[model samples]
Structures are given as C-alpha cells and as structure tokens.
Target: MIIRKDNLLLLPEVYLIIASIFYWVNTSTLFNPFAIIFIGVLLYQVIIKNKIAGLLISSVFILLNLYMVLALISELSEFTTSNNSFIRLLVFGVLFLGLNLIASIFMFKKHLVK
Candidate 1:
C-alpha cells in the first residue's frame, strides 16, 4: 500500500476532533470559539492551494475568532444565576463543540487531503 502526500493533512483533523470531544465532555470550553477558524485555515490551505488566498482567509479567521472570544466573555459575564444565561452558555458551547467535530471531518477530503 502506498500513502499519499495530501492525506497527511488529515492527521491533524482527526486529532483535533478527538480532542474537541474530550474537551466537551470535560467542560473545558477552550476550543469552542475558534474551532471554525481552524477549519477555515485548513480548508484554504488544502483546497484553495494558494498562499495569498490562504493568508486572506487566515486574516479574516483571526478576526472572527477574536469576535467569538469577545462574545463568549460578554455572554458569560451576564450568566450569574440566571436560566437564560445558562441556556445561552449551553447553546453556544454545544454549537461550537458540534462545529468542531464537523469542521475537522469536513476537511477530510479537501485539498489538504487531496
């Protein structure tokens, strides 16, 4: 059996997906906001196959992750013994967790894995 070069890109995705699930079950919430950003970067690197395009996407990706961080903090601050806050936290948390899983898998066959 021969291993292809592009398949190497998938190595990180699998690891990321597993780690994200672990973080979810353990309530880490660290990777919640930026998972999509990672996916975006990987997708561009693998599929776009253009350094310039990847750089542009990465710039936007960083800004978006920053936005997510700010939003998470803002929402968390209002979560003081309130049902609404708890629900928002759960919603955002689970949404990102799921996104992390999908993002990793979605990059599986992209240019990164070509």
Candidate 2:
C-alpha cells in the first residue's frame, strides 16, 4: 500500500527530534549543520510530492533553520576568543550543504525513474 502523506511526513520530523535530543544531551553546539539538510528534505517532500502536510512542515523547517543559523553565527562571534568553533561551524555548514545537494539530486533521479 502507498504510504499516506501524514506518515511520510513524520519520518523527517522524527529524525530531527532525535537529533535535537542528542544535541541537548551532549551539550555540543545545539545547531549542528545536519539540521539544515533535514529542512531541505522536508521541503522537497512537501514541494515535490505535493503533500499538503509539507506546507506546514516546510514553514517550520525554514523558520527553525533560520533561527539556528543566526544563533550559531552569533555564538561563533561570542566564542571568538578561539577560531576553532568558527572553523568547525564553517566546515559543518559546507558539509551540510553538500549533503543536501546530493540528496536533492538523488531525489530528483528517483522521481525521474518513476
């Protein structure tokens, strides 16, 4: 049976929730870059798959990622006593963007296959 949009949408949210829990427990920079890709994935699901649920999910993803990025940059500025945090953030940001692009490409390929 085809999966319902409601159920499909939950998958990425669940991933984000788990990541959030891990971040909280570790106390290691709350907004690690993977979260942005999660937002992009959710957006792809909503936009490409035409799921109505994606509208709300995409909005949340956009807002959350924006806040996270801003907060991360602000914290990096405060932590400027050492450049390590800034470097790490830059590396992770690039990695996240790369991963998001790759995932988007794969998703597009899958769409073409079907």
Candidate 3:
C-alpha cells in the first residue's frame, strides 16, 4: 500500500472532530475552551489560505460556539452574571468571531485583488 502525503494534513482536524464529539458525549466541561481556541486558530489559518478548508473550519467553529453560548446563557439567568469566568468566555467567543471575520475579509480581498 502506498501512502499519500496530502492526506496527512487533515489528520489533526479529523482528530479534533473526534475528540470534540467524545467531549460532547461525556458532557465534559474542560474541552469547550480548548476546543474553541483550537478551532478558532484553525479557522483563521484556513481562512487566510484555503477556501474549502476555511468553510469547513468556520462551520465547526460556529457550531461549537453556539453550543457554548447556549450553555452559558442557560447557566446564567441574567446577562449580568457576577462570574468572571463566564464573562471571559463570552468575551473570547465574541473576539474570536470578530477576528475570524476580519481575517476572512482580508484574505478574500487579497486574493480578489491579486
């Protein structure tokens, strides 16, 4: 059997999807923050380079953030929660979304103008 080097590039993303699914199944709280950051970075990279990869990564990031946002909103009855942790999570999510959008726009413009 011959090995293809191109397939190796997808390994990390595949692994992350699997792990994220497992974390969801286990109702593990620890995975959300890490997963969000990981997916964010991956999305940023893809957005700056590959359209197909960027679409895939961005979709996953949005889905994951939706889950996290719903969880946070549910946990806190009011938006004004005294918990710093929840505030940080919310801030991070918003920032990630903004950064991804900015990166994507720049990438698109760069490619279009070239």
Q: Write the per-residue lDDT of candidate 2 for residues 1-114, one digit (tens) a residue.
A: 889966653455445544545544565666657655554565566456753444445455546556666766776677646677678887786565344333434434434444
Clashes of each: 2, 0, 0
List candidate 1 stretches off by more than 4 Å.
1-3, 10-46, 82-114
Candidate 3: residue pairs that collide = none
Candidate 1: residue pairs that collide: 46-111, 46-112
Worst 10 residues of 1 by lDDT: 105-114
Error of 1 at 41 (Å): 10
For candidate 3, which ten residues in a row score worst on lDDT? 103-112
Residue ranges of candidate 3 with Cα displaced over 4 Å: 1-48, 78-114
Q: Point to the candidate with the largest lDDT.
A: 3
- Minimum summed lDDT over a 10-residue window in model 2 is located at 99-108
Candidate 3 — what's its lDDT?
Answer: 0.55
Residues 11-102 of candidate 1: C-alpha lDDT, one tens digit per residue: 54454445435545566566565554554455546555664544454355445545666776687777667687587786876576456434
On residues 46-77, what C-alpha lDDT tens digit does candidate 3 reach at each position? Answer: 34556565555546555665666676567655
lDDT of 2 at 19: 50
